[model samples]
Target: MNTLLLHCRPGFEGEVCAEISEQAALIGVAGYAKGKPASAYAEFVCTEPGGGERLMRELRFERLIFPRQWARGEFVALPESDRIGVLLQHLAELPVFGSLWLEVFDTNDGKELSNFCKKFEGPLRKALTKAGRLVEDAGKPRLLLTFRSGREVFVGMAETGNQALWPMGIPRLKFPREAPSRSTLKLEEAWHQFIPREQWETRLSGDMTGVDLGASPGGWTYQLVRRGMLVTAVDNGPMAESLMDTGLVTHLMVDGFVWKPRQPVDWMVCDIVEKPARNAALLDDWIGGGHCREAVVNLKLPMKQRYAEVKRLLQRLEDGFAERRIKVSIACKQLYHDREEVTCHLRRLDR
Candidate 1:
């Protein structure tokens, strides 16, 4: 295969194209990306043989900000008659796969194919197992079958431990009924995407104290309270009575932009509705001032030049920290629950 398939949120095809093209050029790979508006996926065609595979190996998927899942492969035309047979025929030419995922675009049409993919997986698995082309080894490459249509499919391979844990890079999280708003999933998903699960006990322990900026109605604060952490919620609006009743939160009526904790906190989270740069600056001040050891904040993006703006904001933070001689690690992602904004995690490395 000479192309890399990138899956992203619908209406963000342009961003994915821009991001992958820039990333590929940085690695000395010559390629061009093709994406249709609202198609929910993009493709990068390599200029040379095996260039796509090289990018897959050399590029750290975590460092990529746009694409949720990626694979190196080529498109294969399938006939409706004996589709399984044709798939197996192609599999014979490739190495054995650890597992298989049948995915479609993240659009209305794609949802229609969910049932088809589900029905087709069982027979395909049985056939691949019989041919010794599919195994249970986690170290083996994962077979990625992205169905653009019933008759057209992209056959790709994703390296184990180098791709998102879920298909299409989306984690399935149910909204907690107790949360005051659905916005709570954003923080929950951010935790899953940014922090490693093994470190949750120490990093998100009950003894840790936190502050939730713009915490009205207690959506983000709800996550902290459930984790058994003491929280100070800052907002002009009143918090949910249910959250206040927990006695773990102390609600303060103040502007998040002007509010500062009296002492350093274990964590600080913000979901304030404001400009991206403004939100970034708030995070910088908190982390640089040592007001919080770690922070999770959402940056609301502009409608135009979104990717460029994000890079600029990230670079600004890096520069600000360098000038202050403050060491910290920052990671940002457009979580499944986010809309026009991206969630960022900043942790003080000096601590």
Candidate 2:
């Protein structure tokens, strides 16, 4: 039971594997990752027994850029009959868990297995309860049962606070029809991922002013208006009529790259389609020049070496802040709603 199973977005298994392999080596845990690209999952098999626990203890899931969720456990192939007995027998070898989650991969084939998982969950939970392998204590690790098929399953465990907030790290955010475009979900998901919900009241309020670059059609602007914010929307393209009616927006028919706010605003968000390096530089200028207190920018990634490019850009951002003697905090993620790009959240913590 020394294998670590990780769930990731389809087409990014290689990036996830590379990241885990590098982290494993850095933490003194020798391991190898196995997974096919576009399979939507990866398995990191440790060299020694109990190495999975060591790796999990040493690594923080939040630091991982690619994997949405990871669990440490053993892989098992169930028998054709008496699947319950086989599962219980295998589960008996591990410690009792606080909760249990039956999951499938994030792929099309995985979606086909959902019905089976749902049908199997009740009986399995009852059996585990009867066998004293499940409990309600938050201190205990969560038992993750990921099914590859009817005959195959992976038994893994993760600490409560150490894993993603939702299954497969995908937040269940609903899109409001009031927003002009579905692209609004990208910014919404970014906020959920980057900003702690509890801090929204103070950091994101109607009193604060903001600017949205490339605000055409008003997807991101809708979010700001809903929060009761006054926003200067910069874009030559047209914005949604509904957003303008809110009386919360000021449209500027100009280029986002050349435009600058008349005064330092509380927030600056960009969703322009541009090279990631250029966007990184733009964000640096915004923070360094004191044009905005915080920003959420999207960087369009190149087709190959996406992870490597993000690493380099992030390092450059850190250096840019350092060179200007600016105190800032930055977080970047390949969001669930984002494709071919990664979103960056930056905030100035000091004057």
Candidate 3:
């Protein structure tokens, strides 16, 4: 494919592919990771089997991007969905739907999709809505559906039948797979919002330590130990044994809210399933108490105005951390692996 699709937040792609590559397993897609996260754009071209979408298996990211440059055709279809479980089955079997090139999104009021919605209903309509928002323009797409079937099992239903015949001279193909994390995170490429890996590598020196709140199964902890820092992973659930074996990762077995580092630490990383405001307040306490020099965490998002919430929480965090002269750099990305919430990477301003 000459074109590709990039999945991310609506406006922050300036730095997504690099962050993705930081943790991406070497086996999958192969392509250049370029573009901007500030515009919520990320494009990576790969000739591998899984199109790098499978990378979500290990890393916590915010978007599912197929770069437009890898696209062999001129047009693509878009869908609106909150989960990927329903889309993966069909995508694995179909040809037109396997790997995509350039995926985009559209909201309910999308101008390009007004006519496409006429043929859909119920869950199908919902899916279409999501696809419309994800496509470059809201219009009848040149792609086919490859999702698992429910009450609706027919393919090409969006058109006449099992096949959609276009002008032979035109080179249009369908995006093959469909998938989240706000835990199953949500990301829109139009926004260029994707996860960052640079912050994870920045470790404190001179006896500084840290804690991983909600550190179950070890996503954030993996990043900490790699930085050569000691981490007390605080959570009620079981942790990844590999992390436990690292000597640097300690299982605290406590609620992050009530727990405190015996003394100041280097960072605090949380992937808690709590309200955004609650998490923000907790970070404030950490900075207010001088417990850590920097932090990176994930905040689960609710259904409405997620973009606005990110802005709101960031303001509160900045102001709260400011009083203590704790300078911070915060990055909120709609990673490919994220379900609906955004990941926050924070650093003390003075760092």
Candidate 4:
């Protein structure tokens, strides 16, 4: 297998290709990416026999912003009469996998295959188990079977810890009925993707205070209230009556761009609709000035050169923080709930 399969949001295949190509070049790997607009996936074909494996080893998956999940392998054509037998024959040449994930693209056509995948999974697992090619070791590589169509599939492998925790790089989160708007899921998903579950008690405890910029009907503020935190919601619009009833949120009517908290806050979150650079600058000012110990904000992307724009904004934040002698850990991702924007988490480290 000399191709690296990558899963991404539909219409972002070019971004994925650009990111992976650049990352691979940085590591001295020779490869070219093939992507189609709205395909929901891309492939990087390596020039050398084991170059795909090398990229998988040397490149940290978390550092790449575009791809959600990645695996190194080749495509296989299966026969309709006996797909399980064909897969087992191929597995005979590879190492035992700790887990198996049967995935499809995130498009309408892919959704149609979900039932087929579900039915295929049971018999495939049974066959792999009988062949001693599937086991229950978390440390082992995960087998990735991405079905492009009924007869066409990509067989790949991803190390357990190096890949996304969910198949197709998507987390299935149910929208809370109590939230004022569906946008509330963005912050909830950000918490899941950025904060470690074990550290939630200490880092995101209820005693911590938070500020929500652009808070209106209180979608983002809803997350804070549910976590039992005292929140100062900044916006000129009225907040949800349900949220006000919680008594944990104080709604302020003011422009998010101009308002500043009187004192430092434990956390600050913004989902304001603004230019990416402007949003980034707001975050910079808050973190560099010690106004907030941590922040979760969204950067709305431009129509063209989206990847380049994101890279520039991220570098700007890093450089600005360094110049100010600020110590902070920054992480960004395009969460499933986001559209035309990416979420960023900035936490000030103890000096």
Q: Give the whole-model CA lDDT for all candidates, comma-separated.
A: 0.91, 0.89, 0.48, 0.91
Question: Could you arrange the candidates by lDDT from highest to lowest?
Answer: 1, 4, 2, 3
Q: TM-scores for all candidates?
A: 0.98, 0.96, 0.46, 0.98
lDDT of 1 by residue, 1-351 (tens): 889999988888888899899988998899899999999999999998889989998988877777888999999999978998999899888999999999988899999987889999999899999989998888899999999888989999999788877898888999899999999999999998888999999999999999999998999999999999999999999899999999999999988899898889999999999999899999999999999999999998866898888988999999999999999999888887888888899999997
- Pairs of colliding residues, candidate 1: none
Scored by lDDT, the top model is 1
Q: Name model 3 segments beyond 4 Å from true.
A: 1-208, 323-325
Better of 1 and 2 by TM-score: 1
Over the full model, what C-alpha lDDT does candidate 1 score relative to the true structure? 0.91
Model 4, 1-351: lDDT tens digits are 789999899988999999999999998999899999999999999998899899999987777787888999999999988988898898888899999999999899899998899999988898898889999889999999999999988999999888886898899989999999999999998998889889888888899899999999899999998889999999888899999999899998888888888889899999989999999999998988889999999998866899999999999999998988889999988888888888999999963
CA RMSD of each candidate after superposition: 0.9, 1.4, 16.7, 1.0
Clashing pairs in 4: none
Task: List residue ranges in candidate 4 displaced over 4 A.
Answer: none
- Comparing 2 and 3 by TM-score, which wins? 2
What is the Cα-based lDDT of residue 53 in candidate 3? 36
| Candidate 4, poorest ten consecutive residues by summed lDDT | 59-68
